[model samples]
Target: MTSASLLPSGLRAWAQRQVGPITAVRDVSRLRPGSRVWELSLDGGRPGVFLKAASGVVAYQRESFAYRHAVPALGPQAAPQLVESSARHLALLLTAIPGRPLAALDVPRAARYEAYRQAGVLLGWLHAAGDLRGEHRVEAGEALQCAARGVEKRLTAAGDRVRAAERRLVLRLAGDLLRLGPLPLGFLHGDAWERNLIWSGRTGWVDFSRARFGACVQDFVPMYCTAWAEDPGLRAAVLRGYGRELSSEEEYALMCLSALDAVGCLAWGVPNGDHALVERGRAVLARLEAQAV
Candidate 1:
């Protein structure tokens, strides 16, 4: 849709060497919102590569670590396979996940049983595998801490903007950050927004920039806030997948993390002059506060 020459110079060279010379690069900027994921044809061949560029050095390095940890254990069917990665770019040369965004799935009746069922299965795998105990537990806690600090810093730096009339939601979410509960560390997709989930016959997730070891609830935030908020009945299916309720401790941890996430997004979205952050922040806060058990 919108393309702005996101190609990384050094990483391009690495791709050429590993996958062969790039005969054609198709800018799939048509993908809406978030990062620009491109499809590259090496030596003008079929099965063009999928490439995602990092925001900067720190992000590039963190995602590279995730690629190293997740691919082997989950197998080719799970996350995208890391074909090649460098300081600027991360190349995924995996089989394309076939499907539409689960967020886009439409079931007018307000209940999409099949979709919920599949989501359960996929999330169960991630939660079970996400534990911080194994050798795979690389920088997971740091990632969560980063999320925390990132939000804190933004709220401080953008102090002027937090009180803006339009950012009430963001501010509201930020206030709720104080009451977040306890949690155990584990591997988690730091950002689990709905669109990241691809739903064909099954649900597959991509984008590991936020993948890190942290609270187990960190893995469930987006699923709860963005996707399941409307019809919480779906929680049962996901719980069935996890084989338990969305525990109170996990709920509190997730609420805090999500508040951090929302406020951080609001802080970054300042340039857009958005006014919805406070509302979002409040919703997260309310969820945790109401569910205190």
Candidate 2:
């Protein structure tokens, strides 16, 4: 539990204005230490709100835009509704959605598969949310080129933290993406994975800090690194719920993107001392190696 006195005065006042006086604030941030996320209890028994204080302006804008534009396509039940925002405080007050994070839930395989299937459905809706005409659309060739450049930059930054073999593998994948021709582009969750998905009765997505427009298959990389890699059936289940199977080109694109994701995990995890992330990166790389062989 957190006291109202503990919150920044400006943010507190802003929240009060939007949702009326808050009665209590409970810190609910998990995963990222020092992140300021609280569940708010309001006076008069109004529905509780979740307040997320962004780390910076960019993250704040991205998430605010997502809740405003992309998430609504999933309908009211599938994601948090933006109740209000305070740009000065970089804070967003959102309607609470029920469910525990899928990563935190212990459930039978059938139940887990159902949750993932629903997640795929929600993701499909999000990707298809808006027309990609005008500035929203990135030309496919340009998008691929940008992705390749991003891969190169991350690899370079990782430097010695990336092993010799891992470096070679990442470069090879980036090269492969260049030859794959144009890929379908649309809105992406940017950080789609089990942890960001919540499940009680059905899957609900949260956190759009990394939301953007890009290759549709890129959204699957996080799951590919975890659930899809461990169980082929889960992969099939999600795709089935997504309403179709990946094309050969998209399948190849997912492999390439997975490689980039793996190296990225290692690069960030090693310095930050997140062993779980480091191991996940290694595991993905091992799988990619096996496939290459």
**Cα lDDT, all candidates:** 0.60, 0.83
Q: Which residue ranges in model 2 land beyond 4 Å of their true spot?
A: 1-5, 139-141
**Among all windows of ten consecutive residues in candidate 2, which has the lowest summed lDDT?**
138-147
Using TM-score, give the best candidate's number. Answer: 2
Count of backbone clashes, every candidate in sequence: 14, 0
In the range 109-162, model 1's lDDT, one tens digit per residue, is 334555566556655566556436555554544444555546647667556644
Alpha-carbon RMSD of each model: 4.7, 2.1
Worst 10 residues of 1 by lDDT: 165-174
TM-score of candidate 2 on Cα atoms, chains taken together: 0.94
lDDT of 2 at 64: 92
Tell me the tens digit of each residue's lDDT in model 2 across 1-293.
34632677777788999889989977777656447888889999788999999979999988998888888888767899899887889999998888889898889999989998998898898888856777678542366667766987788767787778878888988988888876777788888988899899888999888887777888888998898878988998898889988889998888888888877887788888889998998898888888772
Cα shift from native, residue 211, model 2 (Å): 1.0
| lDDT assessment of candidate 2 | 0.83
Query: TM-scores, in order shown?
Result: 0.74, 0.94
